[model samples]
Target: MREWLGWLDHIESVEDSLNNIKARIKAFADNGGYPESFAIIYNGEIAGTVGFNDVNKFNRIGVVGYWLGEKFQGNGIMTKAFESLIEYGFRELGLNRIEVSAAIDNKKSRALPEKLGFTQEGERRQAEWLYDRFVDHAFYGLLAEEWHSDNRED
Candidate 1:
């Protein structure tokens, strides 16, 4: 985990919310009162992780967060990985809605939710801080009903 965290810091474009890198991994493993974390691996290396940030059981809604290291940018790896994760969210987790957000300047990230047909709900100006700077984040969502209808076959 230190390797990944150090890579994030070195990139200068990536920011993580933990003082201790292993602590973050432990918390994710423990779930802190949430569900499991999913990893999409490629060639036996850590590709990335995508999982629920907020999963409301009563409402059956989940917010997913994903991050890919700088070295693996592009090549459509994240898209292929995310499709499987999203499918698991809707099918296995039985979630009604899956939400994703990206910094407005992150053109690479904005494409993920868009390609998946998520509805853009506008930007949150100065909503979050990253690398000592504030950034606008664009919110998006996809409902299970829409997923089923859009991807189903006759």
Candidate 2:
């Protein structure tokens, strides 16, 4: 609750998501989907969160999402978090692919995928209706085989 509240105070969309967390978790469980979520802790304090929502079992895919505390930004922490999530998605979850979408203007979010070598599939024009306007989004994806090969030494 404290983590949600802290994020809520500063992030408008996060504030809205806070209201749906409980019900969303319940729904995810009911649908046989694991709402893989975790909080980043440093010095025993919460620094950020990362998670997947609306996971589809048939397709073996999930949408990635995350946020970091302002103090933790631009330090490669979020990249580590994303790498952890992707590792879990491919290995533990037995997923074939992971997808992410970010507003075109969200440079940090968009850069994270490219940094991890995710292919930018395409842009969805006006796909996200956030902050009371339709904003374009860039979609990126990383395949399980790609991740697996990247880790192989031989």
Candidate 3:
């Protein structure tokens, strides 16, 4: 896990994640915007994380981001977690739109938003500096109206 996540060296350590959690919670409480992040727990273990980021209360929009441990892939865990977060972003947070971006070469990550019915908005060149080089990102977006219409229970 450490080796694979080396690209996220900016995080430095677990303590960084904890501090980020507290900051995000505080930002939400005070401004009604900011990511509502959570650990992805499965079977009493931490599998990964999923959350909404870059929340804009005035514009009613946010970006979604998530990751799952390699061991937990192919189990539909992230999809379920993302779906719940999407619902929360729209229904609970009153957000109008949610976007997701993944490294263009990361097929697995890129497939998630598509599987969840988010439209591929476009690609951004050199959107992320992974480790040594920049990586492009494929963007996807979904609107509250679109989500509700597609997910309406019969």
Report residue 63 deviation for candidate 3 (angstroms).
0.6
Cα lDDT of model 1 by residue, 1-154, tens digit: 3321223555443244334355557655665443445666777988877777677767888888777766777778888778777787788778899998887877777889999889998889987766567778899999998888895542
Model 3, residue pairs in steric clash: none
lDDT of 2 by residue, 10-110 (tens): 44686577766777778657756755777888668889888786577799997887888888888788888889899888877878999998878888778
The 10-residue segment of model 3 with minimum total lDDT is 1-10
Best TM-score goes to which candidate?
3
Model 2, residue 128: distance off in Å is 1.2
| Model 1 residue pairs with clashes | none
- How displaced is residue 29 in candidate 2, in Å? 4.4
Which residue pairs clash within candidate 2?
Answer: none
Candidate 2 residues lying further than 4 Å off, grouped into runs, are 1-21, 24-35, 152-154
Q: Which ranges in model 1 have alpha carbons more than 4 Å from their true place?
A: 1-35, 152-154
